[model samples]
Target: MRIALCALLLTGLLVFPGVLPNSPGHLGSLAETALPWFGLGVPLLLVWAAVRRSVKEVTCVLVPAVAWVALFWPGIVDFGGRDLGRADFRVLTVNVGGDRTAPRDVARRVRATDADVVALEKVPGPAMHAYEKELGGRYPHHAVGDTLGLWSRYPLRGVEKLDLGGAWPHAVRAVARTPVGDTAVYAVRLPSVRVGLGKGFTVQERDASAARLARRVADDGTPRVVLLGDLNGSLRDRGLAPLARELRSAHRQAGEGLGFTWPAAFPLVRLDHVLVRGLDATGSTVLPDLGSDHRPVVTGLRAAR
Candidate 1:
């Protein structure tokens, strides 16, 4: 009986990670998403069995309880993010919809944060100057490309455009020198995935962008780096494998709740993200919408030991 109970726990532990990828139907992704929730039901059942003097059943419960602990403990315990000794500068990233007419208002809000550095995605041509004008004084150091831009309270260097596989100007990579240290920031917006096209989510575009991001970060060798934007897919989805392997989501580590940021009216999935590598994210959260479909993700990062 002990042997059987131990085996059951081991099997559940091994199977849990694969459930979503191998859903019951080959399996499907939905099952993967739902399996963990089903896991909660077992604990309740175990309690009832215990009260009934079902010694054998109670012992069996240990299998899943232990397995789940072994699988998820690292995420739970290692959350403080490497904890580099130096204090981190505050960084803010926003999608800043390309169509927004008043760059001043957007700039006003961005400037209000007074973050050490700011990274922007989906910047439209018309709003560029307003952003420039509004943030001009505070963020003296600046870098601008066709679409994406970076503004910093400190000096900026190594400004360049990143190719996200579609057209030009979807992403940019830059270096900012803060009083604390120098760090790399990537402002990226993956291609939009439309459910109606029969093509499903634009995984191709996201994959290509991930590939580029992986290479850039690999070569950057900066002590700290951040990738910010609307990835359009949840962490559970495999499309973000490349980026996921190298970075940690600030939301997963310090944000309140799930930190959902999409479909602002009623967020379901956390599409937009702030991923960190070679740094410790001390805090993360989702801010109220500034009129865009996606809400903003605010993350505070420090250097990693």
Candidate 2:
């Protein structure tokens, strides 16, 4: 029984979600999203093996244990602080929760990072004025559309709304003329996903939106590009494969730990991301909560010459 359990856990960790059936609530995608958590089973199985005094079972536990370490140990290690000072610029992205009442506080905490660029999502219509008032002095060049906004210290031009096949504007693109060069910055908020008894993990809509966003990014001719926003899905999930194929995640490149940034109180999973192309990620950090449901993700980047 212990051997069987270990084998199952190993298969789940090693198998790509695409190979598994996605029907009945996107089971494959759901498993992939929480992939790292599967390691918990290792401890539980070990305890069970001890209780049963089964030598074979105890040895079998090593299978999943090795697999988990091989798959996730690198991402969990800290390897970023040293290169942070070399970064050319810093960018921050956060989903300030539509219902947040402290826009000024949010803006203040974000500004404290001194990020060269800031991307905000889910800004309530009424609170827009507060954000502008608080962040305008620091980030003079800014753009706002629908629920998404971008603020930059550098001059911004060619600001446009991207059509992600959504009725309301959920993405905006602009060019920031930085000291390094012109970098296309995209502030995006992908559709949210939910899991219910009836629907296992409803991610179809989010996947479709991701496909559209990927196409838009692919079409852009800009050599340096930075994408910041609440992706609503982790990089491990297959739904984000479209964007994952073309861009590199800043956290995976330079962040320490798993970098979870949601449910500000406990942050179990990372729904926010800073993805870049034609640039190197020097460092990444998840900032403290500033009265928003989601914590902000800041990444230091250096434009590749």
Q: Each model's number of backbone clashes?
A: 3, 0
What TM-score does candidate 2 reach? 0.95
Model 2 CA deviation exceeding 4 Å by range:
11-15, 80-82
Residue lDDT tens for model 1, 122-231: 78877787788888888988887776778888788888887767876567778878655777887777776544344434356666777777777777888778887777
lDDT of 1 at 25: 31
Winning model by TM-score = 2
With a 3 Å backbone cut-off (N, CA, C), the pairs that clash in candidate 1 are 20-32, 22-27, 23-27
lDDT tens readout by residue for model 2, 167-211: 787689999997679999999998889999988898987899999
Clashes in predicted model 1: 3
Mark the regions of model 1 whose C-alpha exceeds 4 Å error after superposition.
1-87
Q: Give the local distance difference test score of model 1.
A: 0.68
Question: TM-scores, in order shown?
Answer: 0.74, 0.95
